[model samples]
Target chain A: MATLEDLSKAVINGNVAKAKKLTQELVDAGVAPLDIINQGLIAGMNVVGVRFKNGEMFVPEVMVAAKAMSQGIEMVKPLIAETDMPSEGKVLLGTVKGDLHDIGKNLVGIMLESRGFTVIDIGIDKSPEDFVNAIKEHQPDIMGMSALLTTTMLHMKDTIELMKEEGLGHVKAIVGGAPISQDFADEVGADGYAPDAASAVDLCKSLLSK
Target chain B: METFNTTRSNFTRASFEVNQTIFWQMLSDDQCEEIFMTVQELLERTGVEILNEEAREIFEKAGCWVDGTRVRIPSPLTEWAARTAPSRVTLCDRNGKRALRVETTYSYFGPGQGNSFVLDPHTGERRKPVKDDVAATAVVCDALKNIDFVLSNGYPTDVKEAAADLHVFEALVANTTKPIIQYIPSVKHAQAILDMAVAVAGSLRELQKNPFFVYLIDADGTLVHSDETLAKVIFAAKNGIPFIYHTKLVLGETAPVTPAGTLVVALADVLVGVLLSQLVRQGTPVIAGGIFTVRDEENNMLPWGAPEVSLVGTGMSNLLRYLRIPSFGFAGASDSKISDAQMGLEEAFSMLHMGLSGTNLIQGCGLLESGLTGSLVMLVIGDEIIGMIRKIIKGIEVNEERLARGVIDAVQPGGTYLGEEHTLKYFRKEFWWPTLMNRNRIKDWTEAGSKSLGQRATEKTQSILQTHQPEKLSDDVLAKLREIIEKAEAAL
Candidate 1:
């Protein structure tokens, strides 16, 4: 029987196949699903987060580890009750309209998911209506918009305004990108602003806590 | 030149012939070849997007595949263009005298251009820069011994936007006699700036022969060149002005996320400008380099202080050296908002790394806040840093005299060498003296008001501004420069 420690090590090493196999072994051994998630997968990702913050690991390495942890999470997710599942929060992410840049948004999604948030990425060049409809569909705890161009960043304000018109103002909104700053975020009436992906995760957590 | 020969005479045959100097390489011969081959494949397969119709026509005439704006250059054309581009470019001062030689492993340090804000030397507040800031920057750069060339450190917002490049050039030419690298927005500005340079050089032919200033033309990244950029490239080539075919690659946005992938894209982007220049005029002098920045994944900003910048920048320099093109790159820049410890740390490391790599034109001397702000204090600090880097990159010489066998024998049994004549003969050349750095004892430092590096640098900058008198342009040249600026303003 595979111990939870072995599963955690597999996820930390980013050995996706071994992580999946060990997760299966734990499931066959009748380990609890919540225990497998908290001890095996999140435990490994927690180490990755620390290592990344301490500069011992880089973005790609953390990304690979997150992939491994997510794969293991997928295996045991069906066995758990909806209320019993571990989730920090739900976040909807997209690049603003007329902007095709998505690398930053995708990285934020990966970081949020690794921290146990349910992330729904709406993809690139999303119009204001697209953001409102996605927020209505996902009913996420936070909405994150990204834009790489100065021209396209204006749509972030439009998206927030449309959200207010659609009576979705209770859902906190966050803005980020190369051109997005805290002053612009405040001007756009966003709930918060993050400079990069790591801070985006923190911004979401802080907004949710508030 | 006589002094150089005299200094070299001390090296014995064995020491002179052997490669004993310390050097740094980011890529080996095989790695350079692999990257070069990958760049060629990328250029042929993916090609570049040339937005100018004339540039597209030129590519088509050169037997490249031109589909609308997408131009695919063959490997042979790139190889041929690399061969035709001059390996050495000499930049002259305002007097049309050769001052800087851009070839081989020789590196020259200078400030950057296009900063929007200036750190007020007196008030220490960030504000929009005016035309006087450009002249002040030039004056400081002229007085600094290590800064080999001058670039307008701040973009003058007070001038007309269309002819701001001309005004900045006028200010630089008026204040400093050092060689300048000009930043122009369009071909019109390029022509006007060239007119002002010609006024100083006395004629276009005389200007081209000694080419005091270089035009900076940038390629929009992701293998794209805009219409205005290509026009300036063509203009500079046709007029026989040296220009840096440069671009700034932001990882994961305008370029690939990985360093090697970014290198491929960077080389392809710069080569588009290079090939276009050579297609316009054979033997056109072009320097190839770009400000390589990694997008800080945490901040979502293209950070100037990242170590990856040095790594990728040195790699690009090595590639340019491999292709036998003069290289330009960024160093002595910081992301910090002030001249703090972080600024010093970042600037020192990047300057040391690029200096050791021997990049031809290492820019970014006075830049702060990731190139958004310019600080004269930072320029003074960078001058000191470059002086130290020059000593480090010179490496140690091994000779019968430098090994000091006779001196050691004479100073045996723990005798003091501080009083020896041998120490007196070599101490000045062997040591790098700091102008702004503090080396006083703690008591003496406190007695001297306990100034920090930033305070000392500020004092040095103010002193330079007050005391240093740069060589002025002649009255005839001044009147012609004024007429050209007036015409440019009227046109605008």
Candidate 2:
């Protein structure tokens, strides 16, 4: 009796336990793993995203919904093939060296995650070598560098140079921070720049499409 | 002189047992102390980047640590500057009458400056604002009972670019007698505008004694002071002109994203100007305030309507009140493109918040589209909103006479107190009558054409533009102002 509609409603309401239990029930009921993910979990997250965009839902509620959907996704992950698991893209995020600020970068990571992107945040005060090593390890589709200080923002350019030396030119590089403008992004040869967290999601989507 | 004396003590009471009016505060005493102490620590440790050499030398002479453009002031110097700055600054009208006592819990609402486009009064189309639009805004502000002062609402595009400030000052002084707050770009414009104010006051010393205008100088954010901003501060201080030292810290840009962190940067930005002014001339009348807001990530705009504006604006007002300095704030502004529901909601909430917080000078009356456009219609509607806010902030009286125990006893259980003398005596004083807002029944409202608030405001604006004539300057003063503008035009 645990239908996909009930699972979707649980995800929308951010009931993580209910979502996980329903996903398991649907799997036991012999429903396809992809069907439960597409119709139950992602369908609810799509509604959350729309509501957030329209200002009807706030950040915390969207975050909770994202958590609920991801919990449901974990229930179906082992049953489905890795290639069939839905994901927008893998994004690697870090705050540049000499800048300990991370609030903006963290917010960007949350926003990207809520939009179905796999965000790997390496935390703050990361140097160019750390970024290069993270890119090689995560092999993400896009790398984002954040810096709150003017002095540390220069490290974004250095990271881009090191990425080129490591022959990771195929991975798109994006930069953003309080002091980062589009002109500065262009000067540093970043693929794109976003002003704040919400735009960072859209920037990632556009870059991955290209 | 009589008006000046009475208006000075009008709102400020010598002493009161209980708070006489609605006293709203966002930050507690402990929080205020913490923020102020943190501001001092930030100033002493990080210091600010000063681009002006003379400013650095002034700080160095005052026993501050000056290493090139980085001048760090001791906390004692900052406390001394706060103590030295006058707690109250009085601004006079062009007719030499006190118009605003910029201090304490007294709040005055007015329009903002430098809107490039204006909502055309007749066609309702957005277009570039000209000098006549500036004059029209001044005239309308002069007629509005709640608008306490006037700011150049439009940056005149028709004027010469180099001398636009002088031209705007000329138009404002020519049209309105209310106290003017002018924005100056550089030291030259500051002196030129001061010369014009001197012309109106008849002499330099007279202008200094009762400045009809206050210079508004903005500081570059992120702990930096540009040379032009410093030069203007020096000019305003040396000439004994009262100036508002203002800055805007867009949350997460040019400042820390957190409200407390933004406050630290904001206080640092403003105190740097205050110290520089006081160092140039002790007891310089400097009002410190700024815009603390977040950039809309989606639209990439600094929204004037965001609730953070009220939160941070009230918080900053509380900080300035703690420091005992007159504060300024932004209110009655919106990111909406027109005079619609969003605009009304945004402006009403901000106006109410600023009024409740008792910000001394609340600007942004008619700003629209994130402060890119000005609308006289919006200004008219905002005046009505401010009138309502003023009544709300007046609070209630609980004395015996106001309690009306005797009147209630005499009236007895719904026996038509409308006919009583007590009712006749207290009705007008107890009520706030709306001019534009309708309180009529549906039938009556429909019979009267059932106009929306926007339509009513537009009509009121057109009527004011048609008939409201501001107090004029003397022929001699007018000629002198014209001559100064011409000279600046030629020189620049």
Candidate 3:
């Protein structure tokens, strides 16, 4: 009796166990793995995303809903092949060197995850070396650097330079923060800039499509 | 139809100009009445010192305890003052047109008067402000939409120290047609400034109906007033000059440590001012005004933006509401040395707090470094903040047109309403669009060059300075004003 709509509601309510159980039931009922992943899990997260953008939903609620979506995805993962997992893209995310501010960066990561992008958060105060290593190891489609301070944001340019020198030109550069702006992004040779979390997901998707 | 009244055949037609103010008070009606009662008791029991012979005679004639300059006013006299003072006060612009209709708690915001220094936009240094600085400040205020009136920001160090006020007054009067609330140091200076204003008005009778400036006088601290303070009151009352009688109470220093004790002292100070002004002439337009702030014991400094100041403002507003007089409080000010993050946070809190506390006229805009310096950049950004607060005060409407029930139904179940007719009908009015604050996409912002909010504010100030020109005083009027000042200099 557990339907895909029930799974979507569970994800929207941020009920991880209910979401996973309903997703498993949908899998057992022979619903296509891609259909449950899109029509159920991502469908629920899309509502949360829109609500957050409209200022109706807040970050804690978005984080909780994202957790439920991640759990639901885990339940439907085994039925789908690795190459056909339906991820929009992989993004390596971090707060750039000398900047410990990560609340915005974490919100951006969760938003990307909810939008079907795999977000690998290397945490705050990341060095250019750490970013380069992560780019080589993860081979992420996008590299995100955030800095909330003026002194630390200079490292954004350094990390972008490392990416360029390493010949990882396919990995697009993205930057944002309290003091960061589109002009700063262009000056540092970043591919895109996002002022806030919801827009960060959109920025990654648009950049990946190109 | 049945007859509605016995004396009159039909009920009178009801008509009134719409007063769009979101009225709010932090105290209840009973509590507000209690503050007035406390003020009366303090006046009747603990006598106030009236430092002028004429002022003391008026108090004594109204049954106050007179011992030298110390006079204890009776409760009846204080009540008489509240009853006699005009319930409505109007502010007229330089063109003799009514601008601010002040009788209720409809908040109007403007910068402060007589800042000794101004922040130079070009050099980014705090320097002594001159006459040009006053004109520049007035022009910026004229350009700002939220700034309803002008006040002399610069003390004009270039002018003679004995006549700095006149220079400031002339500079402000020259630059903006907006009504001003500023000071004249003495009774003689008040007359000279009025003469200048009258010259600009083309006649004495025209100046009477359209006094473009309001007088501000200090009641000092508890139970003490200077002679000139009372003299200004008499001049303003007899001449029909609108005035605000105010005091600055510093808790644990000039007043008691507790807010209640300080409130009582402040209330008595303003009441005595009102009583004196009313005694001079009935129906005198007067505002019951005071600023109450406690020193930060930990830091040993006056926290102008402290929450305690807002509390005092709220309590005083409640008292004035019950007394049926206008309220004035401080807002859009900061303790920070610069217009940085701290300035933004503090000013936003103060402006919104005082705006919601039912003040009719709010001051202290563009003030920073604890009211020591005035910055045009901060004044411009303060406009953006007040505009945002205005949107908050507008709130959300839940009626049929605002609710957009049909639009919601149409967009239900994963439908977007971005292209809907309802959206077009309401978005511009409902949403508060920022004029200076950036909301551009990162690529565009980076393309435009990453600018901070401070930089943006500075740029706006620069642009206004370059483009915005104010109405000028006529050549003959200027000559007449200078002549009046010359006469005052020869006499005083």
Candidate 4:
């Protein structure tokens, strides 16, 4: 009999085909859907999260593991309702105008996504209007802007102002850049600033709690 | 062929050759003499311009022909100067206690000087460092046990233009008791700085007898000496003050493209320098070094982190050892913009070479972007890296006590040693401990903050700045130094 532990080991190994097959096999063997996701996929992800946090597992490994979990979720979601699939929160991320630097921004996006947030990425060199439009469309819990240039970081403030003007100011604004500081974030009306990608995940968790 | 010898001492480890733990050599006696003779040939054939007229007159008095400002010395004069120079120098703390005794193959490190931008540890921004940054740098240097001495750690741009050098030195004196390597711009400024040192030492001749500071001068590549630089060199030599004279040779630009060719030019530059210092005042303490750089068409950057540069630096250090003189070289620096893998690898390899090659007075710690940027976090990492190298250089002990023959006998086959007395006695001393590198398990690391090495370095810098107060100078001495600076300010 296939067990949820087998499904978890498959997911931990980042074997997407094996994970989906084992998860289906567990379901056919009369295991509950919640047992497969909560005990198998989520349990595997929890270990990966701890390892990533500890610097034991790098981004590529966790990313592959996350892919397996997502595929397993695709098989398990139809059988469950919205109440079982727990979404942590939503995050909107973009690199502001005149800055083509997006490697760090994309790392933050992956960090947020892997932590259970539904991240909406607006891509690089995005203007204030692009962020404002994405915010209106996604209505995300947190809006994060990244800039590598000192000149391009001003667009973060402009986007915050547009959010205020549109009466969507309840969304928390977080800023990050190579040149960004917490004092600069406060001066520009951002609620948080993270110096690196991993801290961006902590910033999201802490901000969402408030 | 390679040879290995093992010896034992019961109480302490066996002393290696010359009673040192490790030894590494590059240049031999024949090569040393060849380089010295080459320098003599270069000076006589292709002369250096003794830019100052007084220096030119001194060279002429010593039987050197002068064509305008350029002067050439004879092989006999070069041999005399090299022979007459003192082989050792001892530097002292501000309180007049001997702190550093410098001679062959003894390496120490401190921060380099003259950076326009300092990375704010708190905000990670690049800004012009002020007098307060100098204070912070000195206090941190005081707390770092690995850094043997201090320097005018950065260029403070916010002070009065004429008094900036003194202001930086004052901050250094106030915050740390470590001997300083200072830069005095002119003879007038050197006089003021000398007066300040006299006040600290309580007399001029006493300060000369046990100098608390060493001044430095710059040379423009090979055989290009500026007048002010030469003047400072002469002043130091005359007053029996320790002086470091160095030149930056950018390969393919200021020097030959190949490492060997660049080394030839560098030897010509530094040997000529040492020869001149000895001529000014025999038995004067002079430290010679070359900050060698490499530039190819594919990689035209100032390759401070390149293997080619390290090769030349190691060769120069070996040559200095053969000459029985203290040497200056570089380690623990990088051209990367952050404290990333590139910075770590470059610093680790360069530090290994600097250790094995026996380069005394290693500088360029905490420097980034090839000396254009400074970071205190990098300094913290440098302190750790040097500690590791020093541990490696301590080598292994093979004595019967260290071998633990009795303990091994007591523990039977397939038995454990974790519960034995031998483990408890030697584990801490045998292990190489790290302060910043993380060694935590995954869960524990996640529970704590998941911090990077840069973040850890920044936190360490902040705590040291806030809590570490160095030994201070008396109020009267501070006031006297200020008065001397005021006098120099008037002159300027």
Candidate 5:
């Protein structure tokens, strides 16, 4: 039997071809899909994340390894969906209005999704009303706001104020973006401020738990 | 003659003490002079336009020979510099003095939370400055180098107090060197700081002798041929103060989403600043700076290594070099938190690109949270990174002397060359020994406390603060500075 360790090594090696083929082969060999995912794919990715978080690995390495894991997941996703599996959480992410940048937000979404959180990436330049509507409809556990420019990061506060005005205070607001600091996040009345995508994911996880 | 020598020795009891380093060891005083001369020749040979006629006259008077676009300062200028350049400045109060020894190649203070794009400490806000904020900003400038010749940051809330606030702030920070970057918000403050600078310098002639100050202000954000910012730039340049043309290109709003378009906008803004600098004071330096930003798909303004950012930076650097203007560029900037993976990646790439492109000074260091926060911890990390980048830029020098002693041939009979004088002399010069990086075995590392880079950096900061007692300035100079500050403050 092909062990999870074998699949984990494949992912670490950035062998997308091998990881995908092994995932399918293991599933075909009557391996449980959750075990294949949790014990194999996620287990493999966790190492990558930890290594990346520790500076043991660099961006290009992590990026390629992430790409490999995603490729493996593509093969197993539908099969896993057919089974009764619980999700980590749902996160609705967007950049506030007047700010069109989103690389940081995208990284956050990828990391969250990798952690099994279903993320609704609403895209950038979204108004506060758009966020409220998304929260109303999706009822996501967390709404992440991102802004790059110092001037535009101010719009995150406006969005939060608008959210408060609209009586949507129950929804948790997580804020990020370049130029957005813990101090600014505090002033803006955000539930959390994350410096980068890795921390953002960690913050979201902790917030969801709370 | 013997009596005269003794008195001269007494007079020169304490000229100055500088931060000694490998860079200092590499160049003798004569070599430093030669390099400066070479730089001047390079500046003149490059076709950077000299726009100001008055500056041209000054350069001519100073024996600065100009051939087409080339400019060269006569040896007399260097001699004059040795005499007039004060070693230290004393910024002070009635109680005492705060003297700061000047450095030839080190960062002075840069205004704004440019060190880190963070919220203002006083108001807990992330926008423009008010009066008190401007006054208190002197603390930031004071914490920097001692010879603050200009009022750097926190422009006043109202135009009425602008000049006065700037003067007070400049006085508080200005110890010995005249403040170069003083933006008198009003005609009164402008006149005041200028007057104070001239007084401190001893005369208008002295003030004009070396215009090594900067003044920060803004221009109208229009693409038109004429603008107030340009006018301010012109005025400062004409007066011998270099202007920093600072602009931020916010992707998706102020600039197009594409990095190219964003870079173009940044380049255009800088060109205007440079043009204004040249037109106002030919041959005076102008920092054509651009802080470019981008928003990703989810609206997160990520610290991206957009090739366009580097491309434009390199292009601008080349252009400025062609123009023979000293260029200051951005490097070692990271949106990541301290000592993390993101920090490693962000800092490494940013430093490499900026250094490779030949930026004269990389301003945003020791900042975190997207340049909104400052951490002493991060600042030390930045220093290390700067050292690393310097090594990368100082490409290996291969020569017959360096190859040395015919060592390989000598060692053909199984003799070791390790005991040779050549190896002893050259080895130390050829290698950079780091202060904090650990290369010990695991056992030794554990035995030696297993301290991380952060811990080591913290220890170093504490050591510098505790042990490095910078030389103090005279009480008279300190009193003069305080009096000027008080007058400026009362005026405000």
Candidate 6:
């Protein structure tokens, strides 16, 4: 079986091929896919993410590690799917109506998913009804909205009001975008505010625990 | 109706009769007190300018340095220093309105985003800005009151029609009660705009009255010589408009590694522009311009902000202020962070120091993500911050009236000041209520659906666009502007 150091280096160095090969070797050697995934790929990615947070690694390094993690995910997605893989929580996410910009929302989704949240992304320009429908259908623990344009971020308030009027206010709401703030979230009756993608994940996790 | 001149207006268009003393000035009572306090605090506590040996020496000799962060200069010398600084400038466009009393100490400029240039849904490739774009851009310039002047977004594309573009910008800008820094490129184009400005002002006296303007160096902060500089100098001298020398310094991939070396190189380029400006327009204001950005290890321009940039920005601002020349620097900007955190932190920190250091033009208002993009929401946020800083600059009033002597007398018995006539008279004037910043209770906020600042600003922007239609032009003026644009486009 490949040592943790080998797997660690492969992930940190962003060597997707090496990581895949190492995973196969571990699997062939009778090591469980769970161990390889949990202690190897995920653990390695955790390290990469930490490094990125501390500024020890920049965007390119983080990107490379993300690539390696994705390759490993591709190998294990079916296996994990078959076994009802553990997740942090369920989140319903979408950009508010009239707002098409998605970079901020996409970042939040990726970061949440990376943290093991089963994210049901409702896509951009989703109206309040769309969010309510998704929440009812999915029964998500939390609903998140994103908007980038000042013009469209207004829709977040409308969505929140609509959600309340339509009996969906019981679902915890989180809002983020270029212009959204703690004050704005509070103003819109959102349960919490996440300033960035990383913060959103942490906030989601905290909300779940509560 | 009250006479226009009697009104307490921010729009003050006045000039000095050479050698006439306006002794009501010096540092102005408020400026002197603040500077003295700042200097004393800086000198007593921190030994100001210890890093720069030359500045340190100067400080030690002229200031009573108590510490690195504080220094005290005598009031008379402080007044002399303040008097040497350039105060008001005017930014004029073609259609009769020119933003006057525009503080040239600091200003900002940047373009809108790439994909969102055209508002029309059906436009193919962001149709090259026609007359409508010019008119819209002019309104935008007016709305962006923090921007001291105008910069060319796409090249104006016409040497002869430069006058008309200037007219559109000036007409729209007439709404703003601030100065206009005319951004010109080629010499011929510069001449065209200047001629138009002169024609619009109606006389040399009107131009002289608001003579504080800029024939800005359009060399892209590089050393490349261009004919625009020559035209600018000639027009500035002939019409008495000031000149702002600009140089942009990009570090990491563009320049040296060390921040100091980058600053020196940038300063040298600025000095070249300054000298050229002075050579062309004697006694005109020559300002230091350009932004310092960097490329990180990934070569992605690394979020566009560096601490070194701020430090250098402050240092250069102080340097120019001391040298008796006006300067400009990036004030309200951020790297890649797009949220309120980015806006709050970047806008306050960047502009605060520049304003404190007394840089003449601190641009970068309403800009975000390292000046790569802009948001109307961000601009409103910056404006609120500017209001706060203006309060800071105004400082506290410790006079008897402010001390509430009469109110104390009347309320000697247990009573409230809130119900007093004095309170009623002054409360509104004293408070700076932000348009979008909600300070209401959570219940009230939620009842209103807790709209974000962006949401509120969007509504405000729409309302302004819809209701506050600016003063319109006559058919004759419209036809003239169109003819000018048509000829220019045809040639292009």
Name the candidate, 3 or 5, with the larger DockQ value. 3
Stretches of model 4 off by over 4 angstroms after superposition: A1-210, B1-20, B296-300
- Summed backbone clashes in each candidate are 2, 0, 4, 0, 34, 42
Highest TM-score: give the candidate number.
Answer: 3
lDDT of 4 by residue, B342-365 (tens): 888888788878877878888888
Candidate 5 lDDT for residue B63 = 59
lDDT of 3 by residue, B78-111 (tens): 8888878777688888999988877766778899
Worst 10 residues of 2 chain B by lDDT: B1-10
Worst lDDT window (10 residues) for model 4 chain B? Answer: B1-10
What's model 1's overall lDDT?
0.86
DockQ-based class of model 2 = incorrect
How much TM-score does chain B earn in each model? 0.96, 0.96, 0.93, 0.93, 0.62, 0.66
Tens digit of per-residue lDDT, candidate 2, span B17-50: 7667896898998998898898888889988899
CA displacement after TM-score superposition, residue B470 of candidate 5 (Å): 2.8
Candidate 4: residue B393 lDDT (0-100):
78
Candidates' DockQ values? 0.00, 0.00, 0.02, 0.01, 0.01, 0.01
Q: How many residue pairs clash in model 3?
A: 4
Question: For model 3, which pairs clash?
Answer: A182-B442, A182-B446, A183-B445, A183-B446
Model 1 docking tier (incorrect/acceptable/medium/high)? incorrect
**lDDT per residue as tens, model 2, A112-150:** 875678889999899999999999999999999999999
* Superior by TM-score: candidate 4 or candidate 6: 4
DockQ of 2: 0.00
Candidate 6 per-residue C-alpha lDDT over B1-492 given as tens digits, one digit per residue, 9 for 90 to 100: 011012233564576233211111213445434444444333244322223233333435654342552333343433333343354445444333554333534333322221122322122123333434434444554565444454322223233454544544444334333345556555554554554445445555676665424566544443333444544544565566666666667665555666555554555445434443333334455556566766656755645345656666765665454445566766666664454665677777766665665666666555555655544445556666776665565545543456666667665654444334455445656767565577865655888988886566556555554555555545654455445445444543
Each prediction's TM-score versus the true structure: 0.68, 0.68, 0.69, 0.67, 0.47, 0.50
**lDDT of every predicted structure (CA atoms):** 0.86, 0.87, 0.82, 0.80, 0.56, 0.57
Tens digit per residue, CA lDDT, model 5, A68-151: 677777777787664455468889999888887876787787677766788899998998889888888888888899998988
Better candidate by lDDT, 4 or 6: 4
Tens-place lDDT digits, model 4, residues A1-210: 778788778766666668888988987887888778888887887777777777666555565577678778788889999776666798999999888887678777766765677889988888888988999999899999999898888888888998899888999999998888878999999999987666788889999998
Consecutive 10-residue window with the lowest summed lDDT within model 5 chain B = B1-10
